[model samples]
Target: MRGRLLALLIAIELPIGCVTVLTAATAYRTIMGDIEASQVQTTDDFAVRMRVWYRGALRSLLSFGATVSEAALPPELCGQAGLKMLDRARGFSAVLVRSADGRLCSAALDPGIDAQVLERTAASMRASPPVAPWKGVDLGAARYGQASIGDRRYLAVHAQNPAATGQDMQEALLLVAPAVLESVLDLGRGSKGMDIALVAPDGGIVANRGDTPPEAWLPRESRPPAELDRWHAADREGTERTYAARTIAEPGFYVIATFNDPHERDALIQLAVFLLAPLATLSLLCLVYLRAIDRHCVRWLRSIETAARSRSSSKRARAAMADDMPSDIRSVAEAFNAMVDEQEVRQRRLQTALDDNRFLVRELHHRVKNSLQVVQSYIGLSKRDYQDEARTALADAECRVHVLSAAYRFTLADGEMQPVRVDLFLEDVVSMIANLIRRRDQWISSRIETAATLSVDRIIPLGFLVADVASRVLRSTPGARITLSVVDLDEATIEVALEADREVAHQEPPRLFAGLLAQIEAVQSGPAEGRSLGRWRVRHHG
Candidate 1:
C-alpha cells in the first residue's frame, strides 16, 4: 500500500511540475514582450516631438531667406531690412545678402559679424562652385549646410533670385544659431538616461542633449536602421541600448534617441522568482508531509503488522493496534479490532458446541450398550425356561430391542443428533427380523417407499410395531410369504402395509401392539381378508 501511495505521489507531482514550468515560461515571455513594446513606444514618442520642432525651424529659415532674396531695396536699406527680419526670426543668428561674384551685398548680425567668419564663408563658396560640399547638409542645390567658425556651429540656408534679363542673381544666406538646433534636441525630458540628437545625413551629430557626452549619444559604428523606426543594439562600448529615429522633413536629417533599458534584466529576475518560489515551497511541503507520514502513519501501520504477526489473543492484538496510533488512522484500527473480536467470539461458540457434542456421544454409547445387554440377558433367561410360548415372546422382545439398537447406532454415525431416514431404518429392521426367524420355507420381502425421516425417540416405537407385526404373521401362517411396505401418505403422515400369501387367523392385535401404535400416534386400518393383508397409517407428531 505504501508503494502504491508513493507511485501516486510521483504521478501527481510530475504533472504539477510540468504545468508550473509551462505557465512560468509563458508569463515571462509575455511580460518581457510588454516591457520591450513599452520602451519602443517611449522612444518613438520622443522622436515624433523632435521631428515636429525641427521641421518648424527649417520652414522659418526658408521663409526668412525667401523674404530677403526678393527684396528690391537699396543695399543699405536691405541691410536695415535684414536686421529687422533677424529680430523677428528667433532661430537665425544672422542674415546676409551677397553678390553672385562672392561679394557681400548686405549683412545683419545681433553680435557684430567677425571678419574671419566672413572671409571663410567666401572662400568656401569659391572653392565649391554651384553647390558647396558642406560638413552637415547633403543637398546638391547648396540650399542648406552646417558651418563651424570660431568653435560655433551654424546651420546655413541659401536662396538665389535672377535679375530681369542677363545679370548676376542676388543671393541670400540665413545663418541659424546652434541654440535653435539645441532646442529641437532638448525634448528628452521625461525618461532618465536617455539621449536625443539630430543626426545629419552625412552621419555627423548636429545637436545632442542627454545624460551622456555628445560623442557617446550615438555609437560610432552604428547606422540608422532603414526599415524600423525603433530598435535595440550594443553601442561602441558594448553597452546595450534601445534606439528610435525619425527623419526631419526639409533637411533630411534624423532625430534619434537612445534609452538605457534598466527593467529588462530586473523584470526577468522578478518573473523567475515569482514562478519558482511557489514550486519550491510546494516541494518543501511535500517533503514535510512525507516525513510526517513516516513518523505517524507509517509507524502505526508497522505496529499493526507486528501485532498481526504476533498471533496473540484478540484482546492483546486490539490493544497493540490502538496504542500509539495516529488519530487519522484510528477508525481503520477500530474496524480491524472489531473484526478480530467477532472472529474470537465465533471461535469460542464453535469450541463449546464441539465439547457438548462429544459428551452427548459418550452418553448415547453407554445407554445403547446397557440396553442391548439387558435384552440379551432376558433372552438367555427365557432360553433356560424352555416353555414354547415364553420362549417365543422373549425372542420377539429381543428382536425388537435389537432393531432399536440398530436405529440408534445408524443415527449416531454422523456425530449429530439428527433424524434418521425412516425408509432406510425400516428396511434394515425387517432384514434383521427375517434373519432371526430362520425358517427355510418362509420368505420375507420388504419395500420402503417413504421418503421421510424421524428422530431416534420417534423411530423406537415404530421399530417395535414393525417387528411385532412381522412375528405374528410368521406364527399364524407357517410356511407363508410376507411383504411389508412403508410409504409417505402426506407431509405429516406415513403408512405401513404388510401382506401375506395366505390368510392368517383373524384376531385382534395384542395390548402391547396397541400400546406401541398409540405411542407413535399411528392408526391401523387394514387386515382385510382375515389378516392376510394389513396397513397402519402414522402421523408424525414432531
Candidate 2:
C-alpha cells in the first residue's frame, strides 16, 4: 500500500515538472528575444539620425566645391571673398585649395608652404575610386588628418583646385567636423544611461559626445556593424552590456550604441517583481492545495483504516453495518459479517434440532421396549393349550420381536433417527437368537458376519428375519446344536444362515406354524428351510 501511494505521488510530480520547465524556458526566451530586438531598433534609430545630419554636412562640402570651381575673379579678390565666407561657416577646420595638378595655390592654412599633406591627400583620392574626390583629403596639418572643432570634424574635398588662371584655394577646400555628428549622438543619449557615437570605418573618431571617445568606449575592433545586428558583451567594469550597431551612408561611418547594465537594472527589478510576486502566490496556493488534499484524501484513508481495525477486534456488529463505506473496504466487512451471521443462525437451528431429536428418540425407545415386552407376554399367553409345535413357534416369534425392539433401542441410544451400526445390530441379534434357542433345549452356537449398515427403517425387519431362522433351525431337532449368523452379500443385500445343532437327534424340521410362518415371510419374503449334520437348518435373506 505504501508502494502504491508512492507511485501515485510520482505520477503527479513528473507532469508538473515537465510543465514548469517548458513554461519557464518559453517565457525566458521570449523576453530575452524582445530585449535584444529593442536594442537593435534603438541602434537603427540612432544611425538614421546620424545619417540625416552627416548628409547635411556632406552637402555643405559639395556646395563649397561648386562655388570654388565656378569662381571667375582674380586670385587675390577670390581669396578674400572665399576666405571670409569659409570663416563665417561655423566648424570648418580649414579652407585651403589645391591646383588641378594637385598643388596648393592660395590657402588660409599653411599659406606659405605645403608639401607632405597635399601629397598624402592626392594619394588617398587616387586609391579610393568610389569615394568623392573630397573624401579622405587632408585639409590642414591636423594630427588626426582632420580637425574636430566643437563637435564637427573636417577633411578637404579635393587635393588640388581647378587650375583656372585665378581660382582661390580657400573655395576649393571642404571641411569635415565632428560637431554635427556629435549633436546627433547627443540627441540619441537624451540623458539615458546609454552611449551613442559615429565611428570611422578606418578607426578614426568621426563624432561622439559620449563620456569617452567612441573607440575607447568599447573594445578596439568593436564598431557599428555594417548591417543591423546586436550582441552582448562585458564593459570595462565587468558588467553585462548589450549593444546594437549599424553603418550609415551619409556619415560614411559606423553608428554604434550600447545599453548599459545599469540602464536595464530597473526593468530587471520590475520583471523580477512581476514574475516572483505571482510565483510566490502560486507556490502558497499549491501548498494550500496539498494541505487540503491531505485533509480530504489522506485523512479520510486513515479514518477508514482505523474503522477497519476497530471492526477486526470488536465482537459487536461493525458500526452501522458499513452500508455506505467506500467501496474498497465495504465488501470485505460485509462478507465477514455475513459469514458470522450465517454461522450464528445455523448454530441456533442445529442446537434446537438436536434437542428435539433427542426427546423423540428417547420416547420412541421407551414405547418400542414396552411394545416388544407386551408382544412377548402375548406369545407366552398364546403358548398355553396350543399344540407343542405351535407353542414352540409362538415362543420363537416372541423372541424375534424382542430382537427388533433391541435394534430400535440401539437407535434411541444413539439419540437420532438416523442409521444404526449394522455390525452392532447383528451382534445383538446373534445373542438374542442364541439365548432363545437355549431356552428351547436347542444346542445352538451362532456366528454373525455383516458389512451393511442398517438404518432404523431396516433394522427391525433384518433382526426379525435372523431370529426366525434361528428358531426354525433349533426346532428342527430338539436339543440340537445350531449356528446362526449374518454376512454382507453386496451393497444392498445381507445374507443370514442358521445350522441345526449337531448334538440334537436328526428329525424332519417341524412345518412352520401358519402365523409365525406368515410373519417371517412378510419380513424375509420366505420361510427358513434345509438341514445340516442330520439336523434341520434355515436361511433367511433380508
TM-score of each: 0.50, 0.47
Q: Estimate, for each residue in 444-473, the C-alpha lDDT of model 2 and write its tens digit.
A: 555656555556665666566556556655
Candidate 1 lDDT for residue 303: 67
Q: How close is candidate 1 to the true structure, as a TM-score?
A: 0.50
- Candidate 2, which segments miss by more than 4 Å at Cα? 1-38, 72-79, 99-173, 188-191, 211-224, 233-240, 250-252, 261-286, 296-301, 316-542
Q: What lDDT does candidate 2 reach at residue 379?
A: 76
Clashing pairs in 1: none
Q: With candidate 1 superimposed using the best TM-score fit, by how many Å does residue 244's alpha carbon deviate from the native?
A: 2.7
The segments of candidate 1 whose C-alpha lies over 4 angstroms from its true place after superposition are 1-31, 97-145, 157-172, 249-252, 288-292, 305-324, 331-542
TM-score of 2: 0.47
